[model samples]
Target: MSMRLARPGTSDKAETSPLAVRGLTVSYGGDPVVFSVDMTVAPGQMTAIVGPNGAGKSTLLKACLGIVKPLAGRITAWGKPVARQSSRIAYVPQRTSIDWDFPVTVIDVVLMGMYRDLGLLRRVRPQHREAAMACLDRVGMRDFADRQIGQLSGGQQQRVFLARALAQQADLFLLDEPFAGVDAATESAIIAVLKALRDEGRTIVAVHHDLSTVEAYFDRVFLINRRRIAEGPVSTAFTTDTLHEAYGGRLSDGFTARRA
Candidate 1:
């Protein structure tokens, strides 16, 4: 599903976009990873952040979630600071960023998503467990709720993380490589669930690796290479020129030929 998006540089009414980043600049050590970037994620659309390796795609997502402090720029969700809207946002980090060896049960990891609502003092009520189970069921992982998180296969682990995100019942989802290590079936299932969320009017933004599937899975694409290269609907912004600009010399001749 797609919504009519405002043209880049055009004015949008307050609180209209689920996410808006302006003049974003992030640095680690002395080098900047993301520089002077601007992005606006349309509500109810699945948006992809695409670029070559080491292009700061993950950093951009982290900056949006306030996981990394930006050297410059503003990030807001519905016109409010991201820090103030933490509960309304659900984040799924890269599987590689997680400690799969951590000793946590599948259900326990999912229950953690409810901490914002459950608070530090409240007990884990039965209704909360039921809701968590429903989220697991949605991701086809209810049967593995009692299993150790470290024991699951990569795809299963990704599904469990998605379940954790779903448990938030959030309005804007920021996922980092949700399909990186998953099998084809798992990828299909995850995309289906994400599309379902978009159908429900939730906004989804992800750091995506598969260029071939960008047009298929996302309504809008933001091409980046340590900076804002291009961003808009897939049909308009995801062109051969933009891909070349973002991926640089990394893309194969055959790939460019195919895109051409």
Candidate 2:
């Protein structure tokens, strides 16, 4: 849990952070959702992007993945532009954003992660299928490999999507609301898998909503509210004062009562 939170480009080591954003700004039509935010994610640890609803946590994550263009800023993974490092990055978006009715089976969705390595012809060989199955097994979904995606419960679907990301074997994992709408058991299972990955020296940046679990689940925390609020180890940064600054009136009495 003892991790450093370096600013972007402050030193040679900082420049090599798993993910770095400098002066990022984004808007939909009129006003900006995120404005002039700077962030640095340390490698080999799980970092949570914590903020109130509609506070642009997801937008910031999307910008890192190049799913949305920034108004002004630079985003890099491993000291290079994200576009140049796509193969080393894997993203798992919010489950609510997916179309559960899609006709693809569990294994089919998992294999999609291998498309990058399959080349232009996109052939699915036996070895690729075996790899995909292994990924499903990692998330305890191998028994549902042949089932339609829509038939599974919300937690099951989340597990399958995570399996897809696992199949990619990327060094950095970006997830949006990973524990959203999931049961306690599923949440525990997912966190266990993510922790195992962090133990393997992989980096994880997740848009986490649960304040109670923030200190327990993440090594670091980035508190954001339209801009950078605080960034450091959860033990130091996940404080009542900082949480209030990021969540303001949205945060309940239970959080305000907790000690830093």
Candidate 3:
């Protein structure tokens, strides 16, 4: 059996890609972070946003989610404006960006993903708890459901956030470096979950830093460096030349450096 997203609005029948950004530009303070980038992300596939440091990969994801106000261009989902379709999207941010000392338990963090559906005055039901626990089990963290987030390891914490995204129950998932600092086993679990979502026709857009695992994980690659390099299948777009150009002189990872 496959999972399906619950949509509340539509301007067009659900097609291949619901996430599209044209002429996107994001700036902070005075400087531009993402410069006029256009992207069309297709559903039912895992797309990896690969770039070097300061390349604004995270900013691009945020802009599409309407978290950062775009300085230019428009973002759309299902051929309508993003605001109308935001409820169908889920986002998982980097673990390092969060405060580890927060007093929330693992289940508490996962349940936050249901807030959009729960709204301000609603209360959690037994079904929601069951769903959240199922998500935790998918990421191999069900046993630690009651553990405080601050007490978990880096990999465990990352898995918890991913479980939170699953609880969002959205069609499109935007993940920021789910592989960073995770153990190999945790990485495998995350990839398996992402693939399961993709198999169910969900779209996954992730910011990935590991060059070695890119080919194994993503179905398509969007290589960027504040602008655009190339976007295609892993076999073509992730070539030596394109990677070198996008990374420039900053290829520090052992596998990536060897390729260079």
Clashes of each: 0, 0, 0
- Cα miss at 198, model 2 (Å)? 0.3
**TM-score of the candidate numbered 2?**
0.95
| Higher-scoring candidate on lDDT, 1 or 3 | 1
Cα lDDT of model 3 by residue, 98-182, tens digit: 9989888999899999998788988889988899999999999999999999999888999999999999889999999999998
Tens-digit lDDT track for model 2 on 1-260?
A: 02223444484554789899988999987788998888889999999999999889999999999999989998888889999999999999999998999899999999899878987797899999999999999899999999999999999999999999999999999999999998888899899999999999999999999998998899999988887888989988888878878887888987678653
lDDT of 1 by residue, 1-260 (tens): 02222336543632578899988999997799998888989899999999999999999999999899999999889999899999999999999988888988999999999999889899999999999999999999999999998999899999999999999999999999999989998999999999999999999999999988998999999988987888889998898888888877898878879988
Q: Cα RMSD for candidate 2?
A: 3.3
lDDT of 1: 0.90
Q: Which 10-residue window of candidate 1 scores lowest in summed lDDT?
A: 1-10
TM-scores of all candidate predictions against the true structure: 0.95, 0.95, 0.90
Candidate-wise lDDT, in order: 0.90, 0.90, 0.85
TM-score of 1: 0.95
Measured over all alpha carbons after superposition, the RMSD of each candidate to the real structure, in angstroms, is 3.7, 3.3, 7.0
Badly placed stretches (over 4 Å) of model 1 are 1-7, 11-14
